[model samples]
Target: MSATLGCFFLSMWLMRRRETVYGWFAVMSVAWWICGYNQVATSPWPFRSTDGWEIANTVSLLVYSASFTVFILRFCDGR
Candidate 1:
């Protein structure tokens, strides 16, 4: 669902590049999807150690948080 929403938002952004909120939302959604998938997946391939996986998860979380915050700020400010 998150990935779908991300693609939707990405398409929306592509349609209107001036509306950066949509771009940010797309980024946030994709990051959230990554985080969610990491949680559900049994193994984190391409990463040998748990530490690497943890780092990737943390980075995704940070991206989600930052993009969400920016999206909220831009969205609210536009109104």
Candidate 2:
């Protein structure tokens, strides 16, 4: 939790620098944070025996994957 907050602050500071890579990295960090939260919230057995966790996990993974891919491409292409 503290780590996430630290990353958030770092991202904010980086944003002020007006760098494209930092912006993309911030976005990726946000996606990662969301995915981590979802996992923790649904871990150690769900409150209800449903597919909600599976669905949320899938969606989070997709978002994380897409953001990371974009970040890598943008960084590599010097966006």
Candidate 3:
């Protein structure tokens, strides 16, 4: 679902280049997807250890929060 939303928003941004909110929304969606996947995955295939996985997950969550805030602020014309 998050992937689909991210792709859809990305395509929307591509079609309407002037609307930057869509781009931010796409970023937020992709970050959310990464976080969600990290929560549900069985193993951390790419990471060498649990510490790396945790760090990556934490970074993704931070990205998700930042992007979501940006998306909301942009959508509301707050910036």
Task: List TM-score per model, in order.
Answer: 0.93, 0.55, 0.94
> What would the per-residue lDDT of candidate 2 be over residues 36-62, giving only the tens digit for each residue?
776456353553544776676677678
Q: Please give the clash total of every predicted structure, in order.
A: 0, 0, 0
Error of 1 at 15 (Å): 1.2
**How would you encode candidate 3's per-residue C-alpha lDDT over 12-67 as one tens digit per residue?**
99999999999999999999998999868888879988889989889999999999
Against the reference, the lDDT scores of all candidates come to 0.94, 0.64, 0.93
lDDT of 2: 0.64
Clashing pairs in 1: none
Ranking by lDDT: 1, 3, 2
Please report the candidate that would top lDDT against the real structure: 1
* lDDT over C-alpha atoms for residue 77 of model 2: 85
- lDDT by residue (51-72, candidate 1, tens digit) is 8999999999999999999999
Q: Which portions of model 1 miss their true places by more than 4 Å?
A: none
Error of 3 at 68 (Å): 0.6
What is the C-alpha RMSD, rounded to one decimal, of candidate 3?
0.8
